[model samples]
Structure formats: C-alpha cells, structure tokens
Target: VDGNNVIRKIPCMQLLPIILFLIACLYQGERLDHRSCEALEVILKSLHFDFINLQATQLEENGASSLLDMILYYESTTHLDISDNSGMGTSGWRALAHLIKQSVCLSRLDVYNIPMVGYPALSLSKALLTSRLTVLHLHNAQLSGMPIYTLVAALKVNKALRELHLTNNQLNSYQDALQLGDLLQYNSTLKTLELSNNALADAGNMFVFTKLPLNICQSH
Candidate 1:
C-alpha cells in the first residue's frame, strides 16, 4: 500500500500518535524557528489533536509567537502544554493569552516555569475571564501577591476553571491567602488547588482553610 493511502486509512483517534511520531522523528532535539513552525502548521492544519505538547522545544520569542499563531489554526486542541520555554517573551506571552481567549475547545493549560509576574499575568487573568479552561498549571511562574490577586479576581467570575496549581510562586503573604480565601467564597467551580512549596504562614494558611470547602482538595 502507498504511504499516503495508509495514512488516509488511519482512524482519527490513531492519527495523532502517528503524526506525533513523525514530528518526533523529523525534529528530534532541534530548535523550532518560524519557517519550521509554519511547516508544522501546514502538516497539522488538516488534522485534529486534542493534546499538543511543545515543552522544552527551545522556542525563542519570535519562534514561540509563530508556533502559537500556528496553533490558532487548530481550534479543536483541548490540552496545551508549553512548559519550560524560557525564551518566550512579551509577544509570545501575549500571543498565548490571545490564543486562550479565542480557543473554543482548550480546557487544560500547563505553562510551568514561564515568567508570568507582570503584564503576562494580567493578560492571562483577563483571558481567563472568557476562557473555557478547566485545569491551569502555573507552577513556578512567579505568581506573587499582585499577580495572584489578579488571577483570583478573574477566577471569581470564571465558572469554567476547576483545578489551579500555583506551587513555588512565593505566595507567603497574608494578603495572598486572603485573596485565595475570598476566591473560595465566590468561586464555586474550583475543586482542586495546589499550593505546595509556598511559605503561606500559619495565619495565612488558617485564613484560607477557614473558607475552604470540605469537598475541595487543597494543599499549602
């Protein structure tokens, strides 16, 4: 059988693995550039994958932006893991926020170790207001007081999010705990909250725990 004919015969559920295999073979240990990302877009445009992992792809700002733009063509993607891309800057982060707000099927996002302290955090918070995301992992993303406050505020009105991870974000202050406590009171959709490695003091922890629901899973 011809390779093209065999691929055409593959079921939709099985096609993702095959495509991922091809991508791995073609770009193993290689840094992705705009041209490479555009080529990838062409390859992926005709296919649908629920999960797209671009972790540690060595993506620079421009390359990251291009990759994000390419992902916009696949609205059916539900889970996106872009963790460990240390070179992504303002434009890349902004593009990611835009993608989140525009995505119709995205529900889970993992952006671990990305710097989301200032404008990036604010942008993501705004996107959360209208996003369909249910699980969000921002571990080690430098989410301290103000950033945490903004994100919690957004979550207050965002009914779609269910799980949130903010581990190692230096959330040690009472105000940080207070914001989270307030979130528990107003946001009913959040079910799992991970706060490990943070130094939330006894008072802070106590305040947040007081408002925590019995059914909700929480760690501090």
Candidate 2:
C-alpha cells in the first residue's frame, strides 16, 4: 500500500496533531526546531510510529532535547536518524547521551556529521556502556585522536551492538588502529565494522586489517 494512503486510513482526529506537526516541520522545505510531546504521544499510541528522521533540520539544543525526550519517554521509537544536524550543540549531545544511558528501546541511532568532543564524548561513551543500541553510525563526528578511544572503551563491554560505522574520522595513527583492532579481536557480537573513508595510511589500515579475523567479515 502507498504510505500516504496508509496514513490517510488513520482516524483524522488521532493523526491530526502529528500531521500538523509534520506540516509545520516541512513548511518552506525545512524541518523546524519544534516538537509537541503531546503530538508525539498521540502518534505513538495511535500509529506506533517507530522511525523518525530529523536530518539536516537546523535543530538547536532545545529542539534536540525535545527529540531526545520522545525517544527517552516514549516506548515506540526504535530507530532515529538525526544526521547532518550541525546546529545541535553540547546540550543536545548531552541530552542524547542521557537518553542513551536510560532508554532501552532505542536500538539504532544515527548521528553523523554532528560534531561532538571532550566530556560530551566521554559521557556518551559511558552511556554506551549499558545502552541497547545494535546499529550505530557516527561518521565524521570528529571521533579521531583521543575521542575514538572513548567509544573503543565502550565497545569492549557492549555485547549488544552488532554494527559500527566509523568512516572518515582519520584513523591514521597506528595506536588508534591498533586499539580498534584489539576491539575487533575481542568483540564477538559485532558483525559489521566499517572503517572506510578514513585517514589511515597503508600501515595503519593494514594493522587493523591484520587484527580482524577472517570470520568477522563473514559472520553477518
């Protein structure tokens, strides 16, 4: 069935708030930094909306918080794509970290190109310690140098995660690649590990390549 037709089949009164919010979010071909928790609740209860895309929304800290609230408070949302939200700042990342720490229902998270560093990264790393996320995408989130180790630390204990994408974040150094190789060596639950588009020299890439067991590539 067509998606719009499926949406149309829903009771108008039940879906009105969600439709209005989406319309407002789409006016002028831009996603507004606005959210209604009431509307989100209605959508969740009525339609069981499980996926959300807030990509390139120009969302600031407040908007990001609101989105995080839905993921944290609601029980339905499992997959969220917040990629290219360059306007989201420290508060936003922190809020999401908090959500990750507490929410068990969120399984897949995408936050590519949303610069995060320092304490926020560490906090997020700590949150990943107990998170239920299975698929994680952090491409170009400036997760090189020291910050990459934070995630490495979490992956050491994160048995639930299955796929990790760390593309284009300059894993050029031997030490970082070696650490990642060590993680790949130990973490058995993980099936797919993507390190493409990085700044790795031949030696660095080769080091990680050598660490990955042949079965790691074929597991999933």
lDDT per model vs. reference: 0.82, 0.73
Model 1 / residue 182 / CA error / Å:
1.5
* Total residue pair clashes for candidate 2: 0
Best by lDDT: 1
> What is the C-alpha lDDT profile of model 1 across 1-220, one tens digit per residue?
4556666788988987877776785355467766677667645667667777788777788877887876775673788888888787888888889889888878899988887878788889999999989999998988877898899889999989999988898887578888989999898888899989997988888888899987788865
> What does each candidate score in C-alpha RMSD?
3.8, 5.5
Model 1: per-residue Cα lDDT at residue 11: 96
lDDT of 2 at 113: 83
Model 2, span 1-220: residue lDDT tens: 4545667688878677767676456433265565543334444444444677767767777777776766677655688777887766777778788787787788888878866578667877998998888988888888877788888988888888888888877776577787788888878788888888887777877777777876566211
Task: Give candidate 1 misplaced runs (Cα > 4 Å).
Answer: 1-18, 25-29
TM-score for every candidate vs. truth?
Answer: 0.86, 0.80
Off by over 4 Å in 2: 1-29, 34-41, 218-220
